[model samples]
Target: MEFQELINSPGLWLASSVMVIAVVIQAFVFLRAALAEARKVGMSRERYIGGLRSAVITAIGPSFSPVIVLLSLIAVIGAPTAWMRLNDIGAARTELAMVSLSSALVHGEVGTASFGVEAFTYALWGMALNNMGWILVSLFCVHRMSKIVERLYAKYNPAWIRLLMSGTIIGLFAYLLSGQITSPMLHGQYGKLCAGFVSAVTMLIITRLLAKYQRMQELALGLAMLAGMLTAQATFG
Candidate 1:
């Protein structure tokens, strides 16, 4: 297939667009709600106010690089009902190569050779798939943690506060899992399993710490900002 044909593929564009849109919308809605509600909850007024601006820039920075190619791959992957025999292998190789090339470019790793593009491609796609798998699993950790917080808010907290807090944490977790830290974990088979385990523990710890806050919105935003900052440092540092 011609390169242009590859570029013009709608499935690729759709998948990429969805991922980008989801992450963007998720970040904005979460931060905004967190900011507005922070004052109600008694979060350090300064940090709560400043965090939204800081997060918008740094949190979404990483997605700009990979979302394009990632979307294209999603288009080509198509529906599982369209899966084939050797054609599947060929398609998979193409995706793997794209992901590998993208990853190498993003990290300045040595480029994959054209001669073994097929195998390298397979490895790369496998890695991407693995990373996504871990993310989904890690998100479960976030969800369960949010539910606990939800119960706490419903029982002892205000409705607006619960909405703001739950919304922000859920949103941040979704974005963070999609960000760069997930890249390495997504590639390795065992990496996601370890990540999921760690995330579960971490979420529990965060939940406990967050429990101290009577004002859920401010705390949620503050924590989201903190997570976003740490992730940026980890990814680009």
Candidate 2:
């Protein structure tokens, strides 16, 4: 059968559905464990429920972008592969990049006639293999990470450790943002810059204004993202 035919087969659909069901079960298990721990730690049930509701609300806004990307992937690949990859890794951009690289290696590109069965198969293998390293490393390192943290705390003041953590987070975000802001490809596209700036400003304003409101503070990030998207559309679209 052709790659497209194979990807959309009933067998593939069943496999993908099983994987998704497993993820759902894992999520429920973790949630149940966390709630039990929270109760043991004397957290109020109402407060715990409120936090979960706020998290759901916040997640809904950011999830739309990934859903849009998933739709695009479904057109390029097929429903089964798209659903499995998206659900398993939850990183559309990384998955798309790996698929593109695989296609290029096979002398084809996605969404074109040259992307045949061989290219599709190559892309599938690439996606599956590329993410394995991170998973393996995390599986091994997660337990050891606590030891590393303890060493750091023992060697440094608690305040210094906090500062280091905050600085690392800020530096990482700045690095990512700088690439977009300074990219030669985006030199002429001021809309993206404007949107980023607007988003940052919106976040700061919301944080300051909603400092006393716990629920509103939780929504700040989502609202800022929405504002940025709207500003970009108005300016560029």
Candidate 3:
């Protein structure tokens, strides 16, 4: 079967549905637990209901952050797989990275014509395995997290702990971004270089210049991505 055909096949969709279903069920379970806890805390039904409504409203803007990238994922992978992965991990980029790494096992470049069923299968396994690592780590390590945090705070200054957390987030994105920009630089892909630079600048402008606008801040990442993609297309095409 053709790569696209196999990816969108009934069997693939059925397989993907299992994960999506699990995520939905998990969400309901968590919601139930939270509501129960809210009652235990003596939160009135009216207040909790109001809070839920406010939260739902607040979530709308941030929820759109993934949509542009989600469409890209849907285009490269099939809708079912993309939906499953997004629901499972809630991070489009991470899932795409896993797919790219996995597809490379079959000498396939993601979204390229060279990709086939073998590459697709490899990607499936890669994403599953990647998620398994998180599950296993949580199963073993999560219970110890509180003690670990207590020990860290006991040993290190609280200010330094905060700095460490902030630095860790910054370092994660830096690593992901370096992988992207490094390949383009080495391959003389100036269009990609332009895209990255433009995106970075756009992000800074939105975050710094338009800092007063809360909605714009929420949309910053998506706006930057659109700006970058458009710039690259215009410059390269």
**Model 1: per-residue lDDT, tens digit, 62-89?**
4354445444444443222122211222
Q: How far is candidate 3 from the true structure (C-alpha RMSD, Å)?
A: 6.5
Least lDDT summed over 10 consecutive residues: which range in candidate 1?
A: 80-89
Query: Which residue runs does candidate 2 get wrong by more than 4 Å?
Result: 103-108, 184-186
Higher-lDDT candidate of 1 and 3: 3
Q: For residues 102-218, what per-residue lDDT tens digits would candidate 2 score against the true structure? A: 989989798898888888888888887986777788899998998898899999998999899899999999998887777834567776677788899999988896688877877
Q: What is the C-alpha RMSD, rounded to one decimal, of candidate 2? A: 2.6
List ranges where model 1 is wrong by over 4 Å: 8-11, 42-47, 55-128, 143-237
Q: Which runs of model 3 end up more than 4 angstroms from their true locations?
A: 147-237
Instruction: Extract clashing residue pairs from model 1.
Output: 11-75, 12-71, 12-72, 12-75, 16-71, 41-215, 96-121, 97-121, 127-187, 131-186
| Residue 167's lDDT in candidate 2 | 98
Predict model 1's lDDT versus the native: 0.51
* Per-prediction backbone clash count: 10, 0, 0
Candidates, ranked, TM-score: 2, 3, 1
